[model samples]
Target chain A: MTPKKVTTTSGSVTGAASSFSWSKADTIRTSVAGVIVLGLLFWAYLLSSNTETGGRASFSLLIGLALGIVFERGRFCFFCIFRDSIESRKNNGFLSVITALAVGAIGYAIVFGMYLPDTSGEYLPPGAHIGPTSWVLAIAALAFGFGMALSGACISGHLYRIGQGSLRAIPALIGALIGFGLGFITWNTLYLRAIQEAPTLWLPHYIGYAGSLAVTLAALGVIAYYLLKSNTESAPEKVSGLAVLRSKFSPATTGALVGVIGTIAYMRIEPLGVTRQLSAISRKEFEKQSLLPETINGLDTLAGCVGIVTETISNNGWLVIGFVLASFAGALSANRFKFEIPTIRNSSTALFGGVLMGWGSMTALGCTVGVLLSSTQAFAISGWVFFLFAFLGVYLGIKAKVHTL
Target chain B: MSTKKISRVVALVASVALLSSITTAPSQAIPKNDTQTLVSADWLAKNINDPKIVVLEVSAEEGLYERGHINGAIKVSWTKELVDPVNRNILSQASFQKLARKAGIDNDSTVVFYGDNNNWFAAWGAWVFNIYGLNDVRLLNGGRTKWEKDGRPLTTAVSAPALGDVVAKKADASLRAFLPEVLKVAKKQQNTALVDIRSADEFSGKIFAAPGFQELAIRAGHIPGAINIPWKTAINADGTFKSTAEVRKIYANLGIDGKKPIIVYCRIGERASHTWFLLSQVLGYDVKVYDGSWTEYGNSVGVPISNPAGTVWGIA
Candidate 1:
């Protein structure tokens, strides 16, 4: 009897009459993806065995892997999320950010309680992303937001997108390097003028942890309410097992997972930040070329993603590596990997946007993930300021149609 | 005949002994110079390759030594390596001996200590080494900051020299002042100079500790009768110790003429170690570092404190 061929959504052809039949190309792709994933795991194992930074590096890598998968599966790009809400009036992605903030804030409260039981403004939790609230931070966040709109992605967005064969990420990252150098050059002046005496206010210090959590959740609820009200799309149908793995995850599920990952990352290694290693590399190169000031004037003492010049790969560096590779693996497995040749216009725009982002992140002491997500979770007032100004910047950029330019 | 021979021999022996005493007196009277306690960055750069000179980088900041340090320098953690982690005390004699031997320090080795943060921890390391009675211990003048500022070469290469056969002496009590002795001075029972080596804000009870520091006292103030002299005052902009005359004059202006027994302290003893180096090592004064410092003293119950700012714990 002749067998009928059936094409599956996963790009696999199955024989109807036969008990089990799969496409050879699909089988090869799946196998290669599995091998790549296993190789990444082995690399993480090697990193774990390092004597100096083994434990933290390993934890960071694993967290990055989880983040990569979530970012890919959930489409958790900051620019895309904002763009969806602004341009298309889709609020699911925006709601995801709200959910993430809510979940992460609770997780941070629990951790903060354990680390620093007394939040009476006397002591801050060690290694938390609490930065000074100042005009410089406002300007930085606005620039960063505009960069996100123009470049088609935030710093972390560019990172995960690179996995999906985005060639423009190269110029963007290179531009970021130059931007960081410039940031270093101008750091002393900005720091002395604005950031030197800025207040680093923590919500828990004033209202206690419970009150802070309530306020945070209430704020998130308000945002989620507006988002759901604006969303016109119908609810997605539920899928199970293998189909679930192949399909996009719901915003709620994605946000929950991201929150859990962030909490775990903080508990084990450090707060979620994608810019430390990048900034460190830039700072080191600038110092070598005599482009930076002798002293960065209180840069090292301030909290946030303070990058120190180092020859060895830091935990954050390992995290970035894992994020990129695991994202690549996820893309390959989902059949989403497609190499796009970069046009000159796109490349130049990406580079310019990346420069603004890099400079903004440096001046502000962190990017979206570091400042907005982590700092807000920690209940630092700086995070809220960044959030407000960044949204405004993106709104303005979208109105100006900079993304198209 | 016997009496005449004995008398003549006695006279000759007395003359020879007097001549030997005259010969050694001038050498003994010549005081120790700056080179004995401090080595310039230029001097270290020139002699960095010397085997007898064991360079040690003692930093409170993490990953600094691994990032880049003076070539062939040994990394020493001020928190972990220098102190007893379990007990709030300096490392045990056996542990210090082990550390010294592991770092290839010998009895005759010229140990040059340098570190980040203006050599605050490096001077602490020097103080610890002094307690253990290590001979030929010197601090790197200007430390890591000066070396980097001068565009000196740094390497990420870590040195692992052969094990040394050095032994650490029992900790010298004279070099370290405990709370009891400090209390006596605070109570005016002892005529001692108490130098509070913390910032003016800290000394005046305006703040419990410096920003970003976790270790702090519940009560914000300083010991009674202690004078506020920030440790940074002893160092130049380049992080090197000021000239002996300048340092002495600075202290003399504050009525600390090194005549009385001196006890120097800061928040965690590290900054005080810098001042301790200036007073005890450089100026040749009888000084002891109160290693327990404000963390211990201010936390102690019923201790006399002078809080000029009138700050209260958990209130403001």
Candidate 2:
């Protein structure tokens, strides 16, 4: 029997039937998504014109658009990246992270150098949290890593995934909100005892920009070497421009581009954050206000995922709205948007994991993006501390999954 | 005139002259030996019962005092009591006098302030007390954090002491910085120094305004030439004011001698007031609180602004 021909994104002629099936349904979905995006843009324009912060909100909306597009196209997510890297032995996912970090570090150094020259001893980045390094942060990171495994997506990942109609993420998001409240309830004791006096070590504070960059690059190089060593798959063939947009990006390409974009977002708007938005939703509903201490153990000193609660959507909130909208649009265009009610067990796992994520993020003062990426680029000890622990949690979670399966 | 009267008058005149000479020391703005500016946790615990010192806990958030506060310290919400609800500005003299009476402070009562966040709002309390012309207003050394950290006791008991006889004075212009005064300092850039006592982000214009609060300003930048010295720099890791020497050095290293006129501003002057307390009360610097701060300055049109991040007008 003759094999069916596939019009491949990588421009390769394949023998097996293609997994994706595009149809008139996808065309209708894409059109609706496009209209909604236009409506959102118009609404953003009107908002910016009326309110003083509307301009910022509008910018966040655009940022959301870019974030959604890249995330959907690249399939950028912690779980997928880590899973492919570890289990599938896919160098692409791991290479993407290394590239993104390397690029992000350079971008951060450039912006950091310009904004703060010899001022590190005096000035902290406005919204960036380079929280103190302590045992608490380490513990929190481990929980965060574990939570991501259970929940199936990091906070931001779930947000963008929602655009693609990922139903399991809904419970996870809800669980995260509960987790934030729990974190707030338990904050004072933990903060007063450990975080208040925790030693905050900044790489920039100790070593110059060049030194930090060198160390960051070296770490990435070592990881990349391992990620690529055992994999014998050759580089995928490149497609033309339009096909490229539809195709899933290689990890390195996605990582580098996202890194640059994330850096710009921090410099221009605010750091990429989602936990704060979740926390905000919790605060908006929890009218038993005063759940948070006014000072919050100097939590007010840093901004990310933590903020004053009001009805108005924060800048991060706007970014979140944009992310979901654009991702949905992107997914539909790529014929990838699908809605599914997850199984009871998987749904329960996502919800449980999400709660842990919320709790862990609050305890550590940020989620994956806020701590591991934004703060890491700032050379915060909290960033690295969270990263290592989260990685461990992810590893252990994956191991537990193998046992369960 | 009697010879004895002449001799007594002459003695008083001589003492005044000696006091003036001592105050003339350029290095020391106020007497170095004067320990009345700050009361330690132990000192406060000991003297809290004296009935003359009204310990007040000022917080930016509500219900903090109910959580756990310094014994005998009444909760003073910076938003509710200290500020005028209608204008969303500082309280008027009449309102301040009423607040003073509510706190059970008499004309001669010494006010010692304490609160959480290392007494961030407590310093604002001290500043408010000073504005009301309260004599001997002091901040609790190390605030409630140190007191709590050291296992000091906290009481949930509410105090409704006898009404205070204190008279509220008009807000002193010298202790406050108005737009005109700030503008003059920004333009002249001389004997006066403007201290942007906010986080580096606020100073750098990386963020237009503080998070949690509405963006009060359209522009994200500091007053032109204002130095970015965060208010926390005045604090110890334990949430207490650094030693006078350390604080003095902090300002001195920044070329701000307490002798020179200094203006400090933050988002809404709450945090700036903290710096004002440290500089004026603790280090005895001639510092003024620019209560309008970035909210006012950032919104003002045609005013020169310095944004280190070069972030402005929705552009990077």
Candidate 3:
């Protein structure tokens, strides 16, 4: 019998150990790396802690890893999901995302209410959690949502995808920083009139975490079941569950790990943030290095989010950077390494997209993660407003055909 | 295959370990100036109680300081800080020092500053401090607005004059460039290219913040022989500058090679700052941001500018 041949872009895959035929052993090796990295993170966050605050970091990482794995498996990127739903009229990815959000919200509410009682009125850990609502936040959300469509990824998604070599991400990130700066520039006027004037919207305290969680889970269940039933063909490609666990770690998988990272991110740092942290690094470098004037640095300077202070070397900043590098390693191990740069046609789109995001993030107060995800969990009005407006922006961008896609 | 995999793993482990060790010692390294532009909140929170840590809330609005400010911070009016409240341009060093002393800033005090509406004024002030050689200065990230929002302590108390010694340190007597720098660069056209970082209006002399040309008979455009490069083009929406590679591409797109000596300028030199830092510091290029900028040249007694759009001005 003639030897059958399968061709790939870089090389061909034949019957046995073809150049591109990823093996189970290879998958195991990558997964082992992931586990070891997660283990290191656990040691850093939980095992190292001695305070009453406990090892919240480990918990955050665990949760982020689990979520990351799930999202990766589901291909649950906000950009792909939202874009597919609006432009292509495909609903599977969109449905998955909505299900993920609902599931996340339900899980969080139950955990918060059942385990950690909020009797002591301390500020909540700033994590991949939620907070109150404001006009600024609403505007930022709308812009961020629009930005997600334009840039082809949301904030955290952009972070992971960068390792996969998406050129559009660079501009999107730049735009976020500009939006932050603009936010700083206009903060005073906004605060005097809108932000301070707007009432804070609390989720758990008002609705009761348990009831809210139950409602959320139910909502997700309904949506998932409906979407799944209506669109049978949209179900994700399944290998035996064990096979999935054994697939080579690609950017999609890295994204899921990021989810776990997000969980851990919340556990340690102020909140679950990828955009702000990365942008802040750029801002710090600019001001410190004097690449931009110190005056212009106001928007993202260290004082903006965490406070008007810093140590010799920022610990959280370095740790997150380390995570990004680790993610890069994961990407490299999978033989998928490329830098994503924009073409001329897409460059203009990027510039405009950046401009919108900059202005929008400023007005919104934060992006998808900060406003939408965090606020939704926190049960803030602006979070909901952001979600609605952002969805509208994404839809409009898709319909108008004003995007690179 | 196994050998390659082992090598890759070893390389990865070595690189990670190396980076982790290097990152342990974070540098306090910053730009060369009279003072540094930004500071962290952690720094502010720790030194909030220090008397010498004078925080100034400089904003456009007059009574913004009385509403809320850092515990001992005083409100310094931006209009009054350097402007004549008439010229809207660079203030005399003497006048600037007077305002500085009034704001409780001394020659020796480690000033940590911020202001309303994005802390631009504070940054501007920091820039000024650096020019004057006041070594200890930093900007608070997120500024006063964030501090107040986080429910960090804010006070409404305001203080008056405590005249302190403001020692004059003019390191480079020729720091404030006249028409020569532009003229020489334009005339020789050697390794130099003028980068107009000012707004289009200022470049065209449409809205005059400072007198650009008074002595030379130049038109209303950029330098007689230079490029019209806006500073904002270099920044992303997040108020962050583009990466080194991105910036390199931008310069290349403009046909201004990075290897060339680039001089950046704007209406009053404020906007040019972004480009100045980006090129010289970030990209490690041979460049200078003309802080005196267009305001000095456009309305100068008799300098020149290019009139028609897309026309380069050439001095006779």
lDDT of each: 0.82, 0.75, 0.54
What does candidate 3's lDDT look like per residue over A77-168, in tens digits? Answer: 67776777666556665554554355446444543442234524332322323333565666666676677677666665655566556676
Per-prediction DockQ, in order?
A: 0.02, 0.02, 0.01
Docking class of 1: incorrect
What does candidate 2's lDDT look like per residue over A1-405, in tens digits?
000111224545444333555567666866786787787788788767764564678888888888788888888887777766666676565566667777888888887664454534544544556787888888888888888888887888898889888998999898888888777767778888888889877787777778877787787677777767775445544555444435677565677777887788777676777677778787556546656554455665544567556577788888888888899888877778889678888878888888888888988888878888877777777887887898888888888882132
Please state the error at residue B63 of candidate 3 in Å.
35
Query: lDDT by residue for model 2 over B34-57, one digit each (tens)?
Result: 555787887777665555668898
**Per DockQ, what order, best first?**
1, 2, 3
Candidate 1 per-residue lDDT, tens place, B1-316, comes to 5753564466447545555434332112223334357778877776665556789999776545654689989977787789998999999999999999988887867788999888899999999998998877788888888997787988756566677778899999999999999999999999999999888999999999987575468989899999988988888877888888898999999878889889999988998998888888888889999999999998999988899999999884
TM-score of chain A of each: 0.93, 0.89, 0.70
Task: Please state the i-RMS of candidate 1.
Answer: 11.1
DockQ winner between candidates 2 and 3: 2
Residue B11 of model 2, lDDT score: 46
Q: Tell me the spans in candidate 3 whose CA falls farther than 4 Å from its real position.
A: A1-20, A23-74, A114-130, A218-226, A229-233, A240-270, A282-319, A333-335, A339-341, B1-316
DockQ for candidate 1, please give it: 0.02
Pairs that clash in candidate 2: A96-A251, A96-A252, A126-B201, A276-A305, B105-B164
